[model samples]
Target: MKITRRIHSCVEISDGDTTVVLDPGGFGTPDNLAEVDAVLITHIHPDHVDADALTAARATNPELRIYGPEGLRELIDADYNVVADGDTFSLGSLNVEVRETPHEKIINSKELPENLGYLFNDTVLHPGDSMAAIPDMEVVLVPISGPWLRMLMVDEYLAAHRPKRFIGVHDGVDNDNGLTLRGGLLRQLAKDHGVEYLPLKPGESVEV
Candidate 1:
């Protein structure tokens, strides 16, 4: 599978025919969402769900499947699919498992929605804005720099999961100080855990 790391937490994953776009929000472009077969939303944060972009994408590809946590179904209009924790679904050969995430730091207590982290094809895991126990996967997509996750937590999570390859996301847009600090911390943690750590700039693609 091929994964392209878009701006912020957005990523486009494809195995040629079927394409899955995850968290296409603030940093999403019209061109980025053009050929998407499915949309996977992790949370309802502005940075994770751009209404305009999503609408445009849906207009372009009318048959797109939009998947997210349970309550998310009411927020987005379209032929949406609800995916709660432990829920499993498939798009062609790709298998997806949705897991719940804590919204303690990322969102307000009252406004917090059920955030989801996804395990893709049982090979790649995208811990969408959450600190989760990593499943067995070849590549782990982790949020290395974000207001919600501190350096200590990131370090701890990395040590615990210990995947073969780690790609840093949810960064490189705002809060330069936080990004730099987390980047440095992630590098150190990667060395300590003996895992490959890759931090990609927006628009960069990686093959797994």
Candidate 2:
């Protein structure tokens, strides 16, 4: 399978002619949602779900399917298939499984909606804006930076899960210096665990 990392948490995964899109929010600028078979959403935050982009994506590709957690249907204007924790579905040849995780809490913000983690073909886990104890998978999308994250929290999570490989996401807030600093640390951690760590720039693609 091929995974293309977008600006923020958005990523496009493809196997043959089928594609799965995830989190086309503030930092994500997907080249083509028109060909996407399944679009998985983790939460309803603006930076995590771009309503305008999705609305336009559906407009261009009327058959493009959308999926997410409960109550997310109210936030989005387009039609979507809801997938809660422990739910599993299919998109072409890939098996899509859902796992619930805690949305990183902000001190002053209101309670957030449910956050979902998606596991595709049992290979990759995209935990959206979360840092929870997700099941072991070969590849993982780790949040490198966020409002509710700390350096230690990230370090601990990496050490705990220690997947075969991890790609950095949720990094729109990071400046060059911060990214470099934190990325260096993560690289070392991955090296220690004998895992591959990719801090992919926007538009970069990797095979899994």
Candidate 3:
């Protein structure tokens, strides 16, 4: 399988033929939802699941199957298969396992967002905005930029989880100098934890 890094939370994964797009949100344009075999949204947040984009994609590809948290259906009127934690589904030969993880606490008063992580082909795990315990995976799309995150947590998360491959995401917020400096820091950090960090810019794909 190959994972193509998009601008932010959005990522496109395909096994040569069929593709599964994850979190086609506000940071980057996912071109068309019709292109992907399916879409696995992590949450209802616009940054993770842009409703306008999906709605537009569906207009052209009505057969496109969308899967995500059950509550998002109310917010997004689409033909969706609501899924819960630990639920498993398959698209042709592709296998997906849902992991319901608690979103990191950003505020003491506000409730955590319902975040869902996807384990694809038992190899890659894309955790939207959650920094919780990640299941064992060969590669992980680590969120390196967000208001709710810090570099310290990025260091600790990789050190603790220790996936074989580290792919950075959620980095749409970084500026030119910020990306260069932070990219170097993150790459070295991943190496320190014995993980190969691919500095994949937006629209770049890496075969895994």
Give the range of the ten consecutive residues with the poorest summed lDDT in model 2. Answer: 26-35
TM-score of every model versus the real structure: 0.89, 0.94, 0.94
Q: Looking at model 2, how many pairs of residues clash?
A: 0
Error of 1 at 107 (Å): 7.4
lDDT of 1 by residue, 51-81 (tens): 7777777777788788887666555666678
Q: Tell me the alpha-carbon RMSD of every candidate.
A: 2.2, 1.5, 1.4
Model 3 TM-score on a 0 to 1 scale: 0.94
Clash pairs, candidate 2, are: none
What TM-score would candidate 2 get against the native? 0.94
lDDT (0-100) at residue 161 of candidate 1?
Answer: 74
Candidate 2 segments exceeding 4 Å error: none
Q: Which residue runs of candidate 3 sit more than 4 Å off their true CA positions?
A: none
Error of 2 at 109 (Å): 4.8
lDDT of each residue in 15-108, candidate 3, tens digit only? 8578889998877667756778898899887788788788778777888889998768766767888888999988876789998888877778
Which pairs in model 1 have colliding backbones? none
